[model samples]
Target: MDLHYVVQGNGEPIVFLDSGGADLRDWEFIAPSLAKSYRCIAYDGRGAGQSPSPIEFGDYVEDLKNLLDFLDIDNTVLVGHSIGGRIATDFALTYPQRVSKLVLIGPGLTGYQFSPELVQRFEEIQSVAPNVEKMAQLSLELPSYQVVMTSPQRDRMVEMTKHNTLRGLEWQHLWKNLQVWGELPAIPPLNELRVKTLFIIGTQDSEDCFRIADLFKQVPDIRFAHIEGADHMPTLTHSLEVSSIIREFLGESKL
Candidate 1:
């Protein structure tokens, strides 16, 4: 596979999917801790980091499948954050048997409608366009990132996001103009989710993230947890807590 991926330890496989505008390194804190117990694979999604850009809208999902196939993984545990959580959810819904358990941190839902204000915020970011530095600054200014913006991880978050924006704008501009992605397979309703899941979010996260958490209530086998004093980038600020919760959820699966 052309996607850049990192693998560690050895046991039941655990693949980490990261948020938009951030690469596999976003999982730097928690993935290694989990790797000590179970095999962990963290990859830069197509167009995000070292991976090349996608030729189509839904390539992220298929690229993930291909990555697993390349690694000879029959099934795996998925750990995803933000948009990464959205990808993981879509992957599980599309290939139920391939995912054993899910750990989604402040995930985004494919079919869910976002609020006008949040939508406008992103639109403003896009309006800046070719000025990637301004685009990157506007992105991190969202209240959803307030907590992490004030934390020690602030610099790292800024660096990764700016780098992603610089490398990805061209690809994003191409696909956003084509708009063929909306024609892809529809995501089933939240209740139709088949994989057992652990949904965690920071209490300080945006209202929309909490709203999405409420939506997960439709999934029968889901559990919820909150990390105190954290916002969207808990993997950077609350690594120990995130890792511990994931380990507890997986329980005896670590062989």
Candidate 2:
């Protein structure tokens, strides 16, 4: 499928990857700020937004590769969130020469072993099934998301969740398959990554995410930052701080 994408600004290329439940608009608040000096590209992943559905799990890695090839892009920075981060990591490892830098925000690890408690929580969430509205509402009600719900970007975040929920209902089975089938193989050792990497995590994100970040600490060329009071959606809840961190990492003067 030809994914829907938007590009802005000029200079070094930086691609923004959306979370599993979001589209390119997830970066609406943060992308423009970075786009002032860098070429920022955000795209809708398969089954989200205008993108098509029934995307095979294994096809995600290749979908991104194809997107870059079609755009004639190379040696660019990849900034990804949640499941998007998984895609970015896989891409960087598989095509190291094509990636200049990697920014993982609340990233998901490949072959992650979910805690039994987390698994139970997930099962409960799944039990709600096709009731996308309730699922979306429940997501926001989580303690991790409370901070974002009260922030200035709350409306946008809610809208994005609703949009994602609708898409989730539309492609329920495909979405479930993507979650299971897209499971990546064992991650390569951190030392093998020659490209610069940054991890920006929310202090209040799930424990599993924190554990994943701990594992990335072994990477030689990597930096870490913790956003207080933010959660998985830090890009939305803490846009200014997130953008500033990205700007600093890229060595760009503040706007």
Candidate 3:
């Protein structure tokens, strides 16, 4: 499918996955900085930017696997944000040998199911706004809201979001992965995980995400960092800090 991707720098592979509604552009600022130290690879997820939507989340995973195979990249660092983080986690779980490290930003663990009211609000937001202004407004006012991203970053995210909606996919497809995701799948035992994992959560993120991280504390080789004052989109607002952590982790890892 020729999924759009940008590769930079001259070191070990680091594949970046954007948030569900965001494209590779979300990493524009952060990626360049990281590229100076690692061979960072960023690409648009399906249904966003230059990528096309497929029937299932597994298709998205297959696309990632194929991309790695084509690039001859093994033992890589998989970095993902939001739904992108979930995707990275899933890929690492399924193909442990291919991933040497994982960095999740404001990641949504499987156990972090949405409340009925929150789901309804999401639907309401989509129905009323259907455009960038309303969406940005919702981003600011929503109680579950976190820190408000900078205008430029918010604008870019909103622009990419225009192409990232889930239309007729239903809540399950949006939530579950062809029956591949659930409480059982969402919270995997990191004790069993061979790769080192890092979770970067915005201190202002929805409470459910925080609870999920707390729940998974038993997982070995897993660490969590709270980006104080940063919200859901730290990659946009706090790119430098995010990039520094990634670079440090990569430098310390053998792969």
Candidates in order, TM-scores: namely: 0.94, 0.91, 0.82
Give lDDT tens digits, candidate 2, residues 101-165. Answer: 99999988777776677666666667787787777887777666777788887888788888887
For model 1, which pairs clash? none
**Which regions of candidate 1 are displaced past 4 Å?**
178-187, 252-255
What is the number of residue pairs that collide in model 3?
A: 1
Give one digit per residue, the lDDT tens place, for model 1 in 165-185: 987885775656654324545
For all candidates, the clash counts are 0, 0, 1
Cα lDDT listed for each candidate: 0.88, 0.84, 0.72
lDDT of 2 at 59: 69
User: Which tens-of-lDDT digit does each residue in 1-255 have in candidate 3?
Assistant: 477888988887789998766788779878888777679899886666676555555466778999999898877889988888877877887899899888888776654666666666666666564465566466455553445444456566555555454332333345443332233434665567667888888777777668767765755788788787777778887787887777776664321
TM match of model 2 to true structure: 0.91
